[model samples]
Target: MEVAELKAIIEGLLFASGDEGITVKQLQKVLGISKETVDHLLEELKYEYERRDRGIMIMSSNEVLHLTTKPEHSDYYKKLLEVPQSSRMSQAALETLAIIAYRQPITKTEIEDIRGVKSDRPIQTLVTRSLIEEVGRKESVGKPILFGTSKEFLTYFGLTSLDELPPLPDTDEPEDINQEADLFFERFNDELE
Candidate 1:
């Protein structure tokens, strides 16, 4: 493939990697390119975005590459959070928030396991909306970010603290997951609406 096409493919790969990001080694393997070539292409792509004054740019952190919006454009992005309609969380976001609220300092993978769905978007939304935040990193391989309810979360939910959160139902038999979720939502729906 041409150099231009290679660069485009790299952009797609970075975009798909989301917040987790992709490393140069991973990119080289996937693109079947040398490490030097990957570095050169990344630098070229980074320069092109800067030269073009694009709204998004490539960022490298801990050897991982990510496609992210320019920090200079943060005011516009902050405005998105201020919009009243945008303040309302989707069902997925609410569910994710609930999980984090109850299980403070949990990893994304754990959240996904509990929800039984891919929760990247909802996690991102919660983070962006200031309801959840990276409290720390897990003490495991890759050290994934650990999320917890933020101060804003308590205020948004009209709770004095996490202690005010309703208790999860206890049962002798295995409780129905959907029913538990419904109970949680029923209690919080007033705050949500």
Candidate 2:
């Protein structure tokens, strides 16, 4: 196929893939092209968008390729797509989810330990929402079920991979605990509104 045709096909794949970028290998396999050809096509396509003033561009991030609006266009188009509404969790559920997202493969007891509260309700809510799942059985005294975020979580969070999750501070503690709590509750209250 001509380079123009290859670029068009790759752009189609990227647009259809949305925020979850397609991988280079996947593109080559789908297009039945050599790696070098695919790599060259991608660069050409990237340049084409910029040169033509196209609103969207192809991007490769975390081994995934996707067509997305150029960053400057985000404020203009964000509302048009209505980025999927991730269900707002209660304070308890948020705490539970934060723990799971940060320390996945964690058990119920561990969550309870961190929160100093029962996790049954929050765990059930997260499970019902399909945010987390039983990853595997931990080889421990009782073989507790380990839980981790699912692909849905990745899509919901607008992440191509788990590595996209922002690194959290080392400690959850605060000598100025009250200030942090106030800020959190303020934003949490805003979301509720």
Candidate 3:
């Protein structure tokens, strides 16, 4: 297929999928072309967008591609978008998260060591809520899955990255209490309450 036709097909895919984007490999595989050629075409498409000076553009991070409107268009999108109320994390989850964030990529056993209690439930809860995810597996005996915060966690905390986390003093060691209601309530600020 001609580059012009391929570019149009790519643009159509991006628009039709909304937030999701077709990757270079997907395009190359489907088009039966090398990634170098696909990448060159993507550059051509980017130039086309740049020349058009439209509010939408293709973006890629960690090899994930998507087409999103420019930040300047956020106000307009906000008129149609409503912020959903965020759910608060349990204190156990927060404590577990702190250990995970500060000492990560930490294992479940390590988190439990710092907290001095079982963290399975809180870890499971955090994973289930999409706040924490399996970053990798430990190279140790059991090869336990290491947990870390997700993009959702950052958005919930109003942070752009994990580096924005406030430093907790090492002296203020955490403990285990399976049903501590205060910890559950204190997981998030009153604004989230």
Ranking according to TM-score, highest score first: 1, 3, 2
lDDT of 1 at 93: 82
Error of 1 at 103 (Å): 1.3
Superposition-based RMSD of candidate 3 using all C-alpha atoms, in angstroms: 13.6
lDDT of 1: 0.83
Residue-wise lDDT of candidate 2 within 1-193, one digit each (tens)?
A: 8888888888888866654568999998999999999999888888888965688877667877778778887777868656664456677776777678767889988878878767877788889779789999888999999989888767755669878655545555732332343345346446655
Query: Per-candidate TM vs. native?
Result: 0.55, 0.46, 0.46
After superposition, candidate 1 runs with Cα above 4 Å error? 1-85, 171-183, 186-192
The C-alpha local distance difference test score for the whole of candidate 3 amounts to 0.73
- In candidate 1, how many Å is residue 102 off? 1.1
- Candidate 2: where are CA atoms >4 Å away? 1-86, 172-193
Candidate 3: residue 43 lDDT (0-100): 87
User: What lDDT score belongs to each candidate, Candidate 1 first?
Assistant: 0.83, 0.75, 0.73
Q: How do the residues 88-177 of candidate 3 rate in per-residue lDDT, one tens digit apiece? A: 666777778767766678898888887777777788878877878999999989899888888987887788987776645445434433
Please tell me which predicted candidate would have the highest lDDT against the true structure: 1
Which one wins by TM-score: 1 or 2? 1
